[model samples]
Target: MYSSLTEIFKILGIVSIGSFSIVGLCAFLFKKLFDYYLKEELARTQSNLQLKNEKLKIEIESTKQNKILAFKTLHEERALLIKDLYSKLYLLKVEYEKIKLQETSLSFEQLNSIEKECIEIQKVVGLNRLYLTKSISENLNELIKKFERTNEILKDLFSIGENTFSSMSEVSNYKPDQEEIEILHEKLISLISDIIELLDKLEESFKLLLNIE
Candidate 1:
């Protein structure tokens, strides 16, 4: 009986040691697998992040290119608009010089048309303001203000001259008060010069904004 019990205890001890070994080995393998999977997932996430960053950079560059293209398109249209404005100013200046230098006059209809054109110009200038640089915008606005002032002066001058002429009983004759005419001529000339200066500054600002001449 004693020998039999010793044999039984030895068998149980071997079985217990074998089971512990198996459990330990399984736990070690599981740990290795979990570590490998964790590393793989981290690497994949990093790669995806890098790809997204590159895509964002490309999109930003594309947007900047689009803005430059839009600016170029608007620049061409603005150039033509400025030219038209200058022509109108020149016409007004020439007519005023005629009246100032000699006893000459533009018909009421012609003067009225010019006044209407000035109003139209005031409306159009606001549209161009979006495309202009800060310096150009300010300078252009200055010129526009001067133009409006000149238009106001022209209206007053014509009203006075026309009323004076009508009172003289001569519809075809043109005459102006010598002192008032001299003062107006000097003011008009100065205003014209100021407008021209502002125009030049605006052109310079445009070229600088465009990186041109």
Candidate 2:
């Protein structure tokens, strides 16, 4: 009976060790599986983040291009309006000079007729000048407001052109010296020239923004 009990205890000891070993192996396998699943999840999350970042970058670039195109179009339209204003002013100046010359040369009856013509011309010219001036001022004001908004967008979207137009408009409004007025036709001409150049620069900037050759 003593030998049989010893044998039974030995068998039990081996069985217990084997059972513990099997449980330990199972636990290790489960831990490895969990670690593998966590790694896969991390990689997927990183990939999604990268894709989102790329999409944001694309949207930012598209917005910048749109702003540049809009500015270029506005600049072009403003320049054309300025040119028209200058041309009208030039015509008025020419008409005034002719009337002045006629006044100096004519006789009583002829001068009277000439005077009537001059008065009629003055009336028409005055009306036209008033209309042109008002239109130009309104258009300029509108352009300035748009330019201010465009400037803000440019700064936020990308580092781009400075707001030179607003400064130019201010300078154009400054009262001119008599000598300056005589030397130059008028302030309108100078303003138009500046606008033309600015429009050219704007066009180039738009081309670059769009990556168009």
Best by lDDT: 1
lDDT of each: 0.68, 0.50
lDDT of 2 by residue, 73-174 (tens): 765655454454444434433443443333222123332343344344344434444333454444444434433443343222222225533443443344
Error of 1 at 66 (Å): 5.1
Candidate 2 segments whose C-alpha is farther than 4 A from its true place: 104-213
Find the 10 residues in a row with the least total lDDT in model 1: 167-176
Candidate 1 deviation (Cα RMSD): 4.6
Candidate 1 residues 175-199, lDDT tens each? 5466756767787787667666756
CA lDDT, candidate 2, residue 144: 40
TM-score of model 2 (CA atoms): 0.48
